[model samples]
Target: MRVSPINAACCVLLVALLGAASGAQATSIYRTTDAQGNVVFTDNPERGGEEVELNPLTVVPSGQRAPAPQSRPEASASPSSPSQAVSSPFMPYSTFRIAAPRNEETLQTGEAGNLQVELGIEPALREDHRVRLLVDGAVSQSAMHSDVFMLGNLERGERVLQAELLDASGEVRHRSAPVTLYVQRASVNLPQNPNNPN
Candidate 1:
């Protein structure tokens, strides 16, 4: 049977619509590295490359209702009274110790006679806490937050050093083990001339 021109045109339109619909679907893409280490991408499955599956994009039309947001469980309510808040005590400084210039260590002093002090604190120091360096049983340096300190003009003798962690109220919260060290300084004594009169 001879096809009519109108029927032939309808058949062509149907085939075009099917082709367009198929083209809208995502096609598998393959990626591979060549011998020269160059990356190549292709949609041909015969290329012997791993296939990459792409997810279809979803677009929401305007004036349409969107999915409702999920609801999350609320956190437990906080204490309403100050008495409940004070029931727990704050413990700070799990470990504090002097790291540098070990006990009974002898340090050689330079012309300026400067000594460096370092501390080892676990979990680091908090903002509300300050470090104090004790030299010979006194507060030689106080209100320090840094872990390292540079001390100058140390006398030539055995010296004791300690570190204390203080709170905002200047109360000592933790004390490190005392470290003893001797500073060796050059003798300033000059030889007197025998002919010189006293």
Candidate 2:
């Protein structure tokens, strides 16, 4: 079938207008409670229940008038902290504890050092156990025997390491608190005389 040029032009124009209208309607809606305790919304809110506005439109061909990205709410920063995360119901079955290279009262780190972790079961050992170390949700290392897991080449930054202890039944018997290891280059204590032996 032979199509006329005028017909094609009209179809193109129709599509463009529809796209623009849809884009304008696709916006985030914000809600807030009104002074009378009723939920209210407005493109412009003169009073305080909540003021909602579409993120201002911008044209950024040269990246000059780009829109600012939304910032996350302060409460959403970390949902896994001990204070934030809900306590596990299984915690009552087993007691959880973690031993580090340094004392539990304080934590320290070495540049190319190791965090010797020993996970234990309360009331002494009755069954075989496995300990797994997870770094940011990924399994770093798993040990059948309670031994020191080397933490070498730790960068100088705040590192969050998680350790879980599992019993023979493959159930999480215990889990360490998300230990935040503030790693720093270990200060070396060198002997005064390298050549002389006492």
Report backbone clashes per prediction: 0, 0
Model 1 regions more than 4 Å off: 1-90, 190-198
Estimate the overall C-alpha local distance difference test score of candidate 2: 0.52
What tens digits encode model 2's per-residue C-alpha lDDT throughout 87-178? 44233335555556333222344224345556444645444766678765667865455544665555556667766666678666556677
How much lDDT does each candidate structure score?
0.70, 0.52
- Which stretch of 10 consecutive residues in model 2 shows the poorest summed lDDT? 102-111
Candidate 1's C-alpha lDDT? Answer: 0.70
TM-score for candidate 1, residues paired by index: 0.48
Candidate number with greatest lDDT: 1
